[model samples]
Target chain A: MPEGTFCNRTPIQSEKALKRLLEDTGGKTYYQEMKALEVDRDLLWGTIQKTLKSRLRTWLGICAHCGMCADSCFLYRISKRDPRQVPAYKIQSTLGEIVRRKGNVDNAFMHMAMETAWAKCTCCNRCGLYCPHGIDMGVMFGYLRGLLYQQGFVPWELKIGAGMHRVYRAQMDVTDKDFVETFEWMVEEYEEDYPGLTVPVDKQEADILYTVNAREVKHYPEDLAEAAILFHLAGEDWTVPSSGWEQTSLAMFAGDWEACKLQVQSVYGAMERLKPKRMVGTECGHAHRATVVEGPYWAGRPDGRPPVRSIHYVEWLAEALRTGKLRIDPEKRIRVPVTIQDSCNYIRNHGLKEITREIISHIVAPGYFREMSPNREHNYCCGGGGGFNGIGLYRPQRNQALITKRDQLLATGAEMVIAPCHNCWDAIRDLVEEFHVPIKWSFLKPLLIKMVQVPEHLRPENS
Target chain B: MYEFLAGPMFILSLCVFFVGLLVRAIWYVRGLHWQMDRVAYGMYPGPGIKGAARSIGYWLLPFGTYGWRAQPFMTVAFFLLHLGAVLIPLFLLGHTLVLKAATGIALPAMPARIADFLSWAAVIGIAMLALRRIALPEVRILTSAYDYFILLVTAAPFITGLVARYHAGDYAFWLSLHMFFGEVLLILAPFTKLSHIILFFMSRAQIGMDYGIKRGGINGKGMAW
Candidate 1:
């Protein structure tokens, strides 16, 4: 209620422990370790000075406080229109205040900023489209997260996520060896069905150097099999790099800039080593964003691109369908009422809206595909972007935020929601779980594999 | 006091207004690290410029963007405030006469009645915006004493100009106050949030090019949404 203070409705279950964690900064847990870490005023201010570049300074200086961004944000809309959820207010109160104070902030302020950055905003970049001045709170929040990460104020999951990238070069504990073995094992399971199906590993000069999200490698090895199946049937020269195969960057989500650079560089390094004509990442929005869109910048590539051309899985799917490499079986196409969950990282931020539509046209039967209102770039986030889905501290807010997407889904009258991106798929799954919605969700790879018209030569002998 | 305000003070404020904006623009450009910032400015000039133009053009129109369309009343007030702030001062007969007399440059002027109407509209617009800042919870939460101060300072010139034109108060007193506040507004323009008049274009262009070049906003993609 007071000036310069956030509403901070994110409930802390253990107040005493939180207090102790804040005071001592000395627990073995990631959250406690981050909480207990000492505030480095000098480093904080130094980073602030370094990051106070043209974009940020102009955005901060030019904001008219018109509150247009309030309605643009799903968090603001779904939280009963909470003032604190307003994108302009959220960024201004946190990053705006930090810069105003020259980063001479206390531990409490840092924690408050951490909450606002990770919880209130999802870095969806939706609000950027609506701002009259084009002040992107998403980009600013990302920069703020970098500052927060430097000061050890990141959330437990993201901190761990970043550490995983540092330790394993992947978001999970899975190593390069595990990834290669998992792909081999998963492909072998499907080998009998599609004989001679193999996941080409570390194959140099392959036309398409395929990469994947660690989630597919860990929880959903079947996704790897599906990708391999599709590529095999399409007769494309694709190989998965043993190293840098994990495309999603939790480091990017964590606002760990150094880790972000490191994570993306590994992928770039693989691209350089493999000499693949083009790289296609698995169905993950942020992975594409991390590796292709922002990674080049982070890795300091002069052309602002990776070593080889990188494309999203949707692009590859669309291209394959368009080029007659992969044909959808009309009999097997989706006939039930279905809609799409457009991943903001790609659809909005990267302008891959129509590419997904191309894929949808092929896979969905006539009259089966229903479009969500405000689809494509105008579509809302899955309420679990920017590492919101994984953080334990903000689960309530994250779940509450799903109301926007839920209402969108319900209005479409779709029994199934095809979420091409992994984050959207997971968020939709969580949304159905939390809200008990009847709609089922899926990634495109599995759906495509089922619906694709297998060539006579590529098809299993018995089938 | 009248002579100083009308002559030397006005000149001084004008110099500060232009030089201040120029210096601020230079500082902003200089602050940009070429590697970090400029690399994302979009590789293709054609698409980047197109995106930038579209971005600025859309926001200039009343209810042009999704944000504006959502808040109809605020959009009306915003346009009224900006149109009056830009148009009335530049095209008013009295201001043109003053300009012609001072700089020996004659300029076309709008009708007196239209100028009066715009001044009234501007005042009402400012009042509406100020009311929203106080009334709307979302806007109010972001507002501070500094925001209020900015509003008051911005409104002073229009209010005093209206009073002086209509002979509603002491003519000399109101006229002097109008000129003084107008100069103050000019002096404050580049240094405060008022700099948005110029920087708005820059911010929009940066984001536009960011999407246009880096993302697929160009080549007939991402233009619709």
Candidate 2:
């Protein structure tokens, strides 16, 4: 309610002011620009009226004001049971109030709602499991974010993320050319170690069309090389599309629905063009959720499926190990006490809980694998889903949210943590970094590459 | 006055309850677009039905779900209040006699003593729920004036009926008050948050099907948690 700057930082007051801010987009950072952007009441109301459908309406209507959802949320628990952190209270106060008032809310109200939507909840969908009424406040928060985005009330990083997808069709500025070239370069770097390893690009009618997170291309291209080595060792026909290679959708986190459609369509278009029997995405949680679980609905696929049969990297890995195509060297298997971070996006939302376990059984030595209490679908989010990790404005809250996960990991007395998804990996990394927890974390690929048995023929001559 | 309260007023309340709920259901369904909403439910009918059944079935039992198990006191209070609200009306001898008088039909009735016990149990349950709304910070924040009003409206019949049964006050006054509050509850059920009575099933089914069909929960795949 402070008057100087809306939400204490943004000076936006009217639609015209928002328009002027939009025109000058380059003078300051995206966050600074966002702070100056004004509320667009008509657009917000129009979106609410258009998108507030029966699922949300019934959900909003039937919430019994039960605080049972309080414990289901890690934030509420971690924040010392702050009433505002309660999942039901968070959604009810923000989205519920917006709907109750029919979008007649002001900038301060929108900003508060934005904070709750981004910082308070991770859209992990765990509360949906706990609610007797099945209210799914996480889903409602996602819907609320769409309304906030329409009013330009999103966080600076997410706004920039949405723009990246809009302009480059990737989360970061990694172009289609950059993704393919990076994959080829990474494969070349590993070719000396694993003889005859090749990066397949846009191979038509391949059994699997491999996709990857843009972060892998921009920052950790070794993920691509490891994927190639595994697929090559498995002797499976796999191809990565030259374009549409980026699998993660920050637009989803931004709640920019159009950009979500655009990003997923790029991946779906790759599937249509190459016509792979199935598509296997890299080890990223929300990427799978964005492109596989929720992507079909965004793309308006009738059967609620991607163009090709899409599976997570864990699914592919589990299958490869089960079929004896990829064998784990028993001596090389991880001997240290290790635990798994069950990513909510896939494990809970997509039902891939056991598949990850299947991969773990092969990679970890017997009796070395430890399970986090309240694991799998009921597991706490890694405190970084729904774009929480990237937003500087909510960094402190995001860091605090990790306590639930930090304790869950520490309880296992594990030295290493196997986090299969990129979001979980980043979060667990940040958690260890922030809390100085002794546990080390790695993606399945890094550990798998180390332990996977190299076929005699594929091995380099000197080795 | 007894005849009028038991006959015309009771019928009117039932009519409003049924017709209002029907309208609400229609309005809810009308808001859903087939392509946008229905398609997201996925195409696996077997898993969808199984998920829906499991979700609703588990929730109906005492200590059935993880959420219920987390809060022991609230679970006990909730089930007690809901069971009395449902069973007392259907099986109590006096209510059955009224129904028989109106429709020439008979329903199996519970012993008068047992019905009396249930009424008290329900009253206690209501008090417990009301106490949490006031005492628990998390629950209190979400509670509004309307929530307390709804709780009062919901508890009115059982409390008044108990008073009438014990003859603790003027018998005719308590009986008439019980009948009047019961009628008010029926009329308000569909319009107020009490709509959760019916909508809970629909909401639970939607989420179950969503998880089942789209997420492989129907095939018993990832539901380990």
Candidate 3:
């Protein structure tokens, strides 16, 4: 493996800059919230009382304190086994400390608790698989985040993203007109390659309602083009709603359940108005988890029933291949050795490991695919999940936490690493630059375009 | 006094254990809401019941979870200890003999030699766990005095029984002491972290149903422990 193939240009925000951003956001900051918690201890206790339920209590009680989960934590692994960074320690300090103090901790205690709950652990849920008790520490951290959120201690970027989602129905604050313009622009660019490619915006009664990460519009419009190419090639009836297209929710990451609810509700509202038979998300893992898994829980269905069936783009592509709707040109199959980096949301949280591989296998030739040691559900998080990447305040610590993951990627000895999740892509991209790992990163969409072909008659120009 | 401790106090401790467990169970369940996270389409790839069974059954074996796999020696030690502690109490010949005499109901007991070996294994397991708590920095930080207290309470009956059965102490005196410790452990079971004896299955099942059945595409293998 080579070093520093990509330049390490990611800005490390200074503490003062972060504080200034927080002040500009204009609300009670975490310090103020902690002071408030110190004065009215009952408020903190009341929140804990409402939130602490059976599963969490069971997790707290059942943990044998065996320290077996410590080695499983990437942060603990990379940080030279610092006891404070252990997954068990994360729970013990935040939830356990709260319970021990009965919610009457001081401002310093709250500050330490916030650091442990937010910056130390990514809420990746990798530790759950390692737990003999099957305790989902990710969910526990979420509940912890909720308490911290009440104290106005959420990470600044997450706070801003959630605020954007609540106010503008987009995490990046891309308005409806901006979104439509991006789609039109991308469609125009895509038509050069696949003539007559149309990026449908707010197409009513479409079979599939496609959602995207806000980053797709703001940073990587070419990803949208790839998705457009795949959908167009597959001959699938899909539409991207002008509103509710931004799929990823930093609100969920920040523990702002209200903003999270607004994001989900907006998606569902768009779906209801469009009446799509089903919903599909782009190759973004957390977005899929939010829209399909946690969204309904936070934002209820309109009729109080299940929301429209939600599927990941990988699943959609694999199904298309299975049914012969799409074909991969074996000649185009990636001949070089390639490995996959499973996003925590998709692998550990959703169990899409095989499907992820299957999608890659179609694009990559047999025996060319390499599995990372401890791949799939056991894969290490990219240290980007759970809103960790969104918070610029923890940038240095976040990069430090990626050491184990950097080692894992290098160990694979693959030239290209396929990361389906946007967050994973961003994290791996940074880690590759910082650690100077030689692996080139590619997402599933571009790979599918490279390796798969749409039949001539299905092409708009041919028709 | 022997009769009072063995017969009346034993029964009283059993009552406290059962009643306390029942109360806690009710409290746990009553707090639950119907709204839950759901499976995305094609997430669960297998049957729900089988996945749930696999989930609960997997953790019952040594090296079942990823954590246990990482620490093989400790996993085996804990497995052996759990096997002995759980099995011998229910199936030891002496225990069944006494229960049959008292209640006119009995479960078939293991051979005497097997029962004796398990009892010893349980004691050794408890000792190993205690040593680990004392020696390991990670475990030491989390280990409270209450944790050690609970360990003693749990191990006392097994040790005293071994003493009585092997005539290491006066048989009658050791038997009475054994009965006393047994009663105390019973009374403490529901009120202490020992409640995991009952709660483990529920937590595993809840995890299985949520991750295994719902999110793991019906088979819940995605999040299997």
The list of candidate 2 runs beyond 4 A from truth reads A1-36, B34-39, B222-225
Listed in order, the DockQ scores are 0.54, 0.63, 0.49
| lDDT (Cα, tens digit) per residue for candidate 2, span B52-138 | 777788888899887888899999999889889989988999999987887677999999988988888889899999999989999
Clashes by residue pair, model 3: A4-A436, B43-B217, B44-B216, B44-B217, B44-B218, B212-B220
Listed per model, the TM-scores of chain A against the true chain A are 0.93, 0.93, 0.90
Docking level for model 3:
medium
Listed for each candidate, the true contacts retained, as a fraction, are: 0.64, 0.72, 0.50
lDDT of 2 by residue, A1-463 (tens): 2222222233233445444444544324455544555666676778888878898988887888978899999999999999988898898888888888877888678879889999998999899888889888888888888788767788867766777777778888788899888889999999899899998899999999999999999999888999999999999999999998888998889888888888899999999999999999999999999999888888888788899989999999999999999999999988999999999888888888788888888888899999999888899999988999998889999999889999999999999998899999999999999999999999988888888888999999998
Output the better candidate (2/3) by TM-score. 2
Per-residue lDDT, model 1, residue A305, is 77
- The TM-scores, one per candidate, come to 0.93, 0.94, 0.92
Worst 10 residues of 2 chain A by lDDT: A1-10
Candidate 3 lDDT tens digits, A7-63: 111111233433444464433343334344332368778977777777787788778
**C-alpha-based local distance difference test score of model 3:** 0.75
By lDDT, the best candidate is 2
